[model samples]
Target chain A: MIDTIAKLNGIIQILALVLILIRAFLVVRDLTKSVTGVFFMFAIFTHLSADMYYLIHIAMNKGYYPPFSAMDLAALGTYLLFGAAAHSLFPERTGERSETIVSVCAALFAAANVFLWGYYSGAWFQDIFSGITFIYLLVTSSQAVYRTGALKRDKWYILGSIWLTFVAGQVCVPILQNAGAVLAANAVEWLNYSLMFGTFLWLAAKVILCARRTEKDQALALSFGLMCWSLCTLYMCAEPFYQLALFGETFQLLLMWFIIERRVKTA
Target chain B: MIYSENIFICIVIPLLLSLLFIRREGFRFVLGLVIGMLVCLLSAYISAFTGTVSEMGHEQVAVYISPVVEEIMKILPVLFVLFIFDPPSDRVFLFAVAVGVGFATFENCCYLLSVGSQSITYMLIRGLAVGVMHIVSILFATIGLMQMREFKAMSLPAAFGAVIVSITYHALYNLLVSEPGITSVIGYLLPGVTAVLLFLVNLRLRIRVKT
Candidate 1:
């Protein structure tokens, strides 16, 4: 039964990769207007690279690791890919020297990760790269949302990307090392996977909703709802320390959603 | 000694005063306290969970953990006010400040409870610094929201710009405080200066609103 479950998990991951690849291909073809389509393609690349890295790590433990592993290459590739996607999505505005500086800072951070840590420590390198990339995405997406005046559902896109990159890039991998029990690590892993997948689902939904009804208020509500759901879930699962994180996120989500909805309805 | 009880006094007294003195604005008052407490509890919880439940240690709290958690917590009330009342009054800036004060007051209480009369001087410095910083950051975010409301084109960038600014300010503050020597004192003083500047900006915005 355990074997079956493991196999099932593997298959699901594989299927997700395939879906991601198809999306990437479609995006490359320039056939989809959906912003999420582009994001999903990149997400898939990151997701696949991460999964492959773990698979290789596991194989090494079993004394069957392959030389010239795809995982390492994928890790490097995804890091650069994220930077490229972010640059393309939110190109520098004319006369915005500050943004350009920030973008350059992001690139330098990514490069540092690859040069300093990529060769010697796969896990550490990936974490650092992913962390920088997460911040880059947050800054980039927030810029896109701001520039486009697509405020309604854009919050979800920005928040989703931030959460996914931060959780996967910064927290999950490091925590897995000292997780003590396999169960804890596995749970955290699953949670990480769910967050990434959930982000894709959210971005896709926002795109469709926006395309269907260009109503600004509806878009805002949708974004707020998506953020709220994610925040609420995080709040429920978060254990031990109960400072201001969960409540703050939940309140922000709820407030944004409610305000947007009211504004639209009243208008 | 005075600063030891400041947290409880700051949080509870204001809450009671608002409940009694500002009965007409009861919702705002209560909302302020509730949201303030929530942010404090949540940040502490996240810091604790990542450290204990996740067993990730203090490093995680500093690097991957605190930046995202603290920024988001600080912004929640401001975001809520923006969404709900959409207060058309020029006092939106003041409203934002009120929320910030509420948040800082509660957080001060928490810190006071934990530290317990370490040094009145240190406590005052920390309280004033954190309190002012919170107000300034939220006001920045409020300005973004207000700009977005007025100019449709600026909404997205302004809103996000607000968040980034807040985050940047927060990260810098943390970095300064984390360092030893003169940086901590500078960190403590900087937010107050920033708050005064923010107040001026708010005043200017109010003038524009009137015009």
Candidate 2:
């Protein structure tokens, strides 16, 4: 089972990376003109870089040094670009003052998280940092939803509620684990993952029905698909089951594919 | 941060009492001065607070947090004026400059008060370095806001971009000054150089437009 998961993950990861590179090439060839599209490109690039770093590091060694690896830069950079993308996704132009605020805040937050997490050298520091990121993501996503008036539709609420539930479950996981309720913790985690999967499917459905044939829809669908698969791989993996590397590569390929599709359409 | 009733008595009350002495014509400048000091105070308090919250010590706080806090604090009054009164364009520049200078002066006073230094050389350096740095930083933000105002209305992005410029300048200055020797010398000279360049550019633009 471990070997199978690892193989599956490797295939997905390589495919994703290839797709992202192809999409980047298409973007270079004047495939899409959207600002969000450009941001998506950067986000995908940095995210893939971080994912690739993880894969390479896992393959080479056992222990990880957060600072030495320099993956946090890519991870945090991706988050910042994602924030910018969310803002750009809106049709309406934001006022200069607010944009300045957002840009500064985003920069500060990313810099602080990456460096602080790298330097802190404490157990659970990474998890704590991840929690902070999730909170930040929640805040930014809600702001984007509100600012873009994406909440006018009930789909946002549905996705948001499910996401919130999953996060809440994540928050409770440590407590459950620490209390030695391993089975209960696993049950809650799996339950939350199921909800998250449902939310992703819902989001992808919306993207398909609403954004059909567009690069945005394709990107969204591809991301959701990769994330679902990655989580599944994680579920199947154990201490010796190293599938994260391939899952990461698969992500890269999916984005590259989106880019290529846009190019072909424009061509 | 000796922020107590003593501060209220020494700074706030005296400023309020002095405000009564000024006529309506000079009242705005005085108000700007007092508000600028208050903004500086806020910057100190908030920077310290955030530094503590973020688990930063003195040096880290000074290096990382102070720039963000001080830049934001210095610009608050300008933001208020922009949002509330809708002051005329040229006059708005004057108001911003006043606030900047006032902020710097107050900050200088606080620094001297804390250090109890009487050296004229130190005062001159502090006046030119820290004071002018504050002024220049505020100017960057205000000018950005003003230019954006002229172009497409002061947007959040433009304002945020301005804040970024202001913070970057301030942070760079702080980091440079935190070092000793030549770096500190460069840091001290940097703001004055920037201000001169800015002035020359404005003058040149005015001349070009006149022709």
Candidate 3:
């Protein structure tokens, strides 16, 4: 079962990567059209880097940097880079000050990782580090949704739904697990995957809609990518939850296609 | 210090020969290659020089320092070209590739010198791995170059973006192969395989764009 889930996740990750690389290839000649392209590039590549780091960890019994594997740290890097990308996409909308604040916060997080690399020895610290990063992402992404005016628009309803569903699942699963309702907890977990899948689909719809409405749709695509990643990180921490990761990565690929298709059409 | 003499001889001969070979059809690529190799050598010397000054050991240099040094070295001339020629961005990518190819060729020659021609199979695989890596690093930077285009001019953020992507990719490759056996197997094939896959994707995307 673990192998099957991992294989599915692998295929999804590859799809995500291939889609972005295709977009990269398309724009390899002219990434100037979208400032967000670099963020997408960093996000995808770091993701692949993290994935490879995990593969090495398990295969070679290395990278167990006490409490957290190097892959965990790499995952943190991806999250921050995505956060920056999301904020950078809507400078006019998100405000320069907020972006600068996020940058400083992210820099602190990166410093914490470097410190952990040398001195970390406890899981709780790692978890708290990740949790703090997750919360920061949630806040920034919320601001992104508002800054992009997605909160007010009917078109952004799906994003709100996706975020709400993910948050509710996160809140409920632990409660159910604590109640010793193993069966109920399992069910909510599955629901998390299903709802996220739907939410990403919704996000995909919004990306295309925004592409039509905005001149800098790639920024929107990147912002969408950040939200998907944030949701995935929130839910996909354990192996059984690996299935949810497929959803976030799949959403990224879908958006990648939307950006490329939009670009080709406009060109 | 061990490599300076041979690397210099290697650079100077090619540099002089390329100067004479200017009328050749592939001279521009060779020029890119030799210049790239020279930069690669210069980068190595700089890193060596830096190593002497910094407290980090040689292992740290290989895994951490070399990528930053080599990537900056590899992209310097390309950046110059980008600024001076201001060719279409696509041409910039192509130019970067030319430099990558050149750098890889010289670096391979140096490797052969240090490690011996060895078994052709080993040399061939190493060549393929290093060549692909060199190309991909520049491509990674070029991809970074594309991202900053929104500003409508080359800027620090743009250059920094390019370096970050390039450095991370370079560092990732170094880390992956930092292990041996199974990790090495994937590491060896990864660059070459991915480079081909990227080419195919680009080709297919181009066709789709046309139709």
Candidate 4:
């Protein structure tokens, strides 16, 4: 069952990669492009690059994942690119003291996870790298939200909260499972699925509303990518329905691509 | 057992001396080559140590760990130069390719020394595949770095993301080529295909920029 899911997940990524390559080709062809659009495309590329490693691991290990590998760095690259996109779109500088505090806190939290879970040294290295990048994403993304004004803040909040809940479910599922609370773990997993479904429906509504708007906000479009990325990372951490997670991610990418295509056509 | 350092020393001395006659970009390329060879040697030691500590087989280590080490070592100089000298994007790209070439050349030498250069076809494939793979991977990272810098979004996540693209590409190649036969053929062709695509994309972009 797991192997089948892994293979299916790999297929989804390949399909998504093809879609991304087409989108990238289009974006690259368009001479009049924003920095945010470029970064957004690159973010997808980096994320897909990391997925290649994931696919290779599936083939090599027959669905069993190694405790740690350098490929995780590419996933980190995905977040970094998204952060770059957020920064480019918003271009607001946050307070260094606050950024530092978040960094410290993230580092401490990562360290706690490392010790609490007894992660290997290699995993610890990646965990720290992710921690630092995650904080950067949070800081830049919040800055982006702040810069987007009042009207679109609700969209950011909704998507952001859904991502947070999914990630929280990811965290709890493992802890619950480890503690022999199988029912609780199962419950958390179901909640994650429900949240994913809810987000999908919510995004569908938003896409419709966004399409109807006269001035399509770039910030909201970028936020969708960010939400998809956060979802990707959460699934990558403790993947229960790994294939489903990837399907959701690719679906989000498709929607974003559709938006870009529509905008270009209208332009 | 291969004495990589001996080969490195023998090749590097002449190159180091040639640097006196060379200037500017030529100097940077030669210097990058020399640094790349040194980095390759260091990477070998590190990989060996890691293999020993992890109790992994040679093939396992090569496929799983060495790509990460090699890619990181290859990019360190580029990163250093970027942050310190703050050179133009073209210079950085040239320097990066040079480092990759240097690293590939040294690796090929060691490989040839270990296994006799009997099979011309195999050697050709190895040279084209491995050499271009190294250059392509590093160039990918360099381009990412340049993009981030150009956009004034040069943060840790951005830089690392750029670096990790190379690492993942290297790792994927390593993973693919580790097994022989069909997979190996695909692996060998992957870099060349990617390079051609990148070249075409770059040409298109340059034309757009000019127009």
Best by TM-score: 4
Candidate 4 predicts chain B with a TM-score of: 0.98
- Note the DockQ of each predicted structure: 0.01, 0.02, 0.16, 0.55
TM-score for every candidate vs. truth?
A: 0.43, 0.47, 0.61, 0.84
**TM-score quality measure for candidate 3:** 0.61
Residues A226-246, model 1: lDDT tens digits = 432333243224232122233
Writing each residue's lDDT as its tens digit, candidate 2 over A1-267 gives 775566456546645755765545434434223444445554554555455445543543324332312354344445444544444445354564644444344334333433433433353456455434433443454445444433344644454355446546755665799999999998986776566455545544544443354544334433433343333334323334334424443543454355335544554
Can you write out model 4's per-residue Cα lDDT over B89-195, one digit (the tens) per residue?
98999899999999999999999999999999999999999999999999888887887777677777667777777887888888888887677788899999989
Off by over 4 Å in 3: A1-42, A64-144, A152-267, B20-31, B46-60, B147-159, B176-180, B205-211
Per-candidate alpha-carbon RMSD to the true structure: 19.7, 13.0, 7.7, 4.4
Task: Give a tens-digit lDDT track for model 3, residues A145-258.
Answer: 556555344534554445456656756786898899999999997887677556555555656666666544443644455564435553445656546655565565556545
Q: Over the stretch B126-161, how does candidate 1's per-residue lDDT look in tens digits? A: 778888877776665565556545533223323443
Candidate 4 chain A, which ten residues in sequence have the lowest lDDT sum? A112-121
Regions of model 4 farther than 4 Å from truth: A29-33, A62-67, A93-129, A150-192, A212-215, A218-222, A225-240, A260-267
> What is the number of residue pairs that collide in model 1?
21
Distance from true location, Cα of A128 in model 4, Å: 5.2
**In order, what are the TM-scores of chain A for the candidates?**
0.41, 0.61, 0.66, 0.69
Better of 1 and 4 by lDDT: 4
